[model samples]
Target: MIIEGTVLRGPEFDPVEGRVVVEDGAITAIEEESVDSSDIVVPAFVNAHTHIGDSIAKEAGAGLSLDELVAPPDGLKHRLLRAASREEKVEAMRRSIRMMERTGTASFLEFREGGVEGVYALREAAEGLDVDPVILGRETVEAMEAADGFGASGARDGEFSRERNATAREGKIFGIHAGERDPTDINPALDLDPDFLVHVVHPEPLHLDRIEDSEIPVAVCPRSNLVTGVGVPPIRDLHERTTVALGTDNVMLNSPSMFREMEFAAKLADVSARDVLAMATRNGAQIAGLDCGVLAEGRPGKLLVLDGDSDNLAGAQDVVRAVVRRAGAGDVSDVVL
Candidate 1:
């Protein structure tokens, strides 16, 4: 397969007029030359954190507190999920996955609820889709064993040493939520030595030091935090300390669009557009252990091509800036997953 466009090449996403050659799904080479296409080729986005099961309940609990909206068991999000039938849930999830496909997301790291069955349900949702999902089963060790990893709700919610240990023993990853509402639970979550953490929106000085020392990768969902009344994450600080990726969080709270996530992240942080683009791509892939986030040789051929001449993106002096802060679903021309 040969894809021709202005390829965003390598980790820094340098714009190169070239054609990407893919052999057996792996990028073999990038031949730099003038191409006759006004397409912007970028690495397919990797959304590092998501609770896609909440797709059945989009915009359901408006004006609710953070805890009231998503704090496990009897929370409104869980209540809505419990009320929905398996078929309804699966269909809703499928629609969200389809939307992600149209917006140029190649993969996502899903923090799934409903145990082992939930993992299988998400798989069913993605049966014929090109966009793949890495499901992390919540609440049980068996669920973790059944899925790619375990996703704990938070450190304050419960102790997760058993699940964490089991995941490590089985060579699977374990991720937990921490410091979304406050700084208190950050220590405990960090102590679990999780593979990654989600929503560290309130990291204190000690927590920052710990994050730097442990080299933990944090997946930040700033828009979700803002919507739920929790403060936004320190994206630039976290990015400087460790690997930081962008996520859209619950579909109930926000749309599962990497474009929106990248836009918010780029505008919210003082970081460059290139770094924000990496957060929406390679950094997330690093957190999830995927090799398809960079458009480089010896990587997977997953790519997103947008029409540079589209009304929304035309006349931009900087391609990366346009993609990070301005581009939308309408600008996408093809998703070469």
Candidate 2:
């Protein structure tokens, strides 16, 4: 198969008039030449962090505190998840996954709620879909064993040393939330030495130093922080220290759309458009260990083609800027994932 357009080729996302050739499911070649199409081909997105389990409760708790909204155990999100039937949850999650496909997301890293049952439900929801989910099961080591890894609620919630060790023993991903509300839990979360930290909204000098020294990655959710009244992560500060990626946290608080997350993050942070685009694409893939975030030879054939001539994006002087800060769902023409 051949897709002709202005391909944003490779991790640098350099624009060139070209065609991408795919055989089976891997990209074999990127041939540069003049093309008649006005399409912008970019790598499909990898959402670094998400909690799509509460998808059945979208926009349910407005004006709630960060803790009241999502702080585990008896948080409103947990209550909603417990209240919903498995069938209902599966259907809602399925719809969200389908929406992800339509919006050009190739994969997402999910902090799935419930336990082993929750992990299985998400797998059921995604059984026939192309939008892959990397699930980190919460609550139990058995859930981690059943899923891809363990997703701790936060350091404040419990002692995760055992779960972390179990995940390490199994060679699976281990992630935790830290510093969302304050700098208090950052140290404990860091001590576990997990694969990634989510929502480092209040990292202090010490935490930043530790992150830089450890070379751990972060998944920042700007929109969710703003909506929940927690301060947003310092993108420039985090990016300079270690790898930082973008995530749209909690379906109850925000839509699971990388385009919306990228636009919000780019305009809110004092970073270059290319850096923001990297946060939306390759940076997230880097955190999740996925191989399909960049357009390159011998990589997975996963990319989105947007109509550059569409009224929403027509005549944009900077292609990366337009995609990162201006383009929307309407600009998408085709998604090959």
Candidate 3:
């Protein structure tokens, strides 16, 4: 398959008029040449963090506190999940997964609720869909062993030493939520030596230093934080210290759309469009150990093609900036996942 367009090539996302040659689902070569196509080609997104299990709870708690909305056992989201049948939960998740695929997301890293059953439910949701899911089970060691990894709620919530150690023993990924509501949980979450930390919305000076020294990657969800009444993450500071990725977080709060996440991050922080694009793409892939997200030779041929001639994107001056700060699902021409 030959996808010709204004290809956003490599990690830099340097626009080049060319055609990407794909052979057996791997990008074989990127031949630079003038193409008569006005489509914009870029890497398919890898959402680094999400709680898609709450798809059944979209906009449920409109004015609830952060904890009241989603702090586990007694949270409204949890309550709704408990009330809904397994079939209802699966259908809702499936719809979200389909929406993600349609909007050019290649994969997502999910912090699934409901233990082992939760992992299997998400699998059922994603079955037969081109979009991939990296499910990190919550609550139990058995759940971690069943899924790809373990996703901890936070250090302030409980001691995840056992869960962390179990994931390590099984050589699976272990991630935790930290510094979202306050700086109190940052140190303890970092102490677990997790593979990644989600929502560093309140990183202190020492926390930043420790992150730089440890080189831990962070998944920032600016929209989710804002919706939950937490302050926006210092995206520039986190990017400066370590690898930073973008995530839509709870489906209850926001749509699982990389375009929206990228745009929000670019405008919220003083970072470049290219940096935000990387956060929406390759940075998240790195967090989940996926080979996709970069448009380069030998990489997986997961690409998003947008109609450059669309009314929403026509005559754009800067390709990268336009994609990051402006493009929407309506502008997408095709998603080759």
Candidate 4:
């Protein structure tokens, strides 16, 4: 297969008019040429963090605290999940997955709830979908063994030493939530030596230093933080220290669209359009250990083609800025995942 467009090539997303040759699901070569196509071809998005198990409760909790909405156990999200049947949950999740695929997401890193059963449920939900989900199970070591990794709730909630150690022993990814509402949990979460941390919305200078020393990646969910009244992550600071990726967070809080996440991150942070695009694409792919998210040779042929000539994006001056800050699902022409 050959795709000709203004290709956003490599990690820096340098725009070049070219034709990308793909064979057997791998990118073979990118030949620079003056292509006639007005299509924008970039890497398909990799959503670094999500809680898609709560797809049944999209925008359900209005005017609720973060704890009240999603602190686990008896929280509104958990209650709703418990109330919904298995088939209903699976169907809802399937719909969300399909929506993500339609919106140019090639893969997602999911913090699945409900233990081992939860991991299997996500598998069922993702059945027949082209979008790949790297599921990190919560609650138990057995659940981590069943899934891709272990996702901790937060250090304030519990001591995840056992879970972290177990995942490390198994050579699986281990991630934790930290500094979302306050700075108190950041140190403890970092002490676990996790593969990555999610939602550093309140990182202190010391926490930032620790992150810098460890070179840990962070997944920021700005929209979700704003919805919960928690401040957004120090995305510029985090980026300065280590790799930073973008995520949509809970399905109940926001839709799992990398386009929206990228736009929010670009506008909210001091980063440039290219940097935010990397957060939505290559940065997340690095965190998830995926070989996609870049238009380069020897990489997986996962590309998102958008119509630059669309009414919304037509006559745009800056391609990266338009894609990150302005483009939406309606502007997408195709997703070759």
List runs of model 1 lying over 4 Å from the truth.
Answer: none
lDDT tens per residue, model 1, 1-337: 8888889999999999989998988899999999998889999999999999999999999989988999888999999999999999999999999999888888999999999999999999999999999989998999998999999999899999999999999998789999999999999999999999899999998999999999999999999999999899999899889999999999998999998888988889999999999999999999888887999999999998899999998898999999999999999888888
Query: For model 4, how does the per-residue alpha-carbon lDDT over 1-337 read when each residue is reduced to its tens digit?
Result: 9999899998889989988999999999999999799999989999999999889998898999999999979899999988998999999999999999998898999999988999999999999999999999999999999999999999999999999999999999999999999999999999999999999999999999999999999999999999999988999999999999999999998999898898888989999999999999999999999988899999999998999999999999999899999999999998898
**Cα lDDT tens digits for candidate 3, 95-180:** 99999999999999999999999999999999999999999999999999999999999999899999999999999999999999
| C-alpha TM-scores of all predictions | 0.99, 0.99, 0.99, 0.99
lDDT per residue, candidate 2, 1-337, as tens digits?
8999899999889999989998999999999999998999999999999999889999998888988998768889999889999999999999999999998999999998889999999999999999999999999998999999999989999989999999999999999999999999999999999899999999999999999999999999999999999888999999999999999989999999999999998989899988988898899888888898899999999999999999999999999899998898999999999
Q: Which 10 consecutive positions of candidate 2 have the poorest summed lDDT? A: 66-75
CA lDDT, every prediction?
A: 0.93, 0.93, 0.95, 0.94
How big is the positional error of residue 56 in model 4, measured in Å on the Cα after superposition? 0.4
Looking at candidate 1, the ten consecutive residues that score lowest on lDDT are 99-108
Please report how far candidate 4 places residue 148 from its true position, in Å: 0.2
Q: lDDT at 150 for candidate 2?
A: 95
- In model 1, what are the clashing residue pairs, if there are any? none
TM-score (C-alpha) between model 2 and the true structure: 0.99
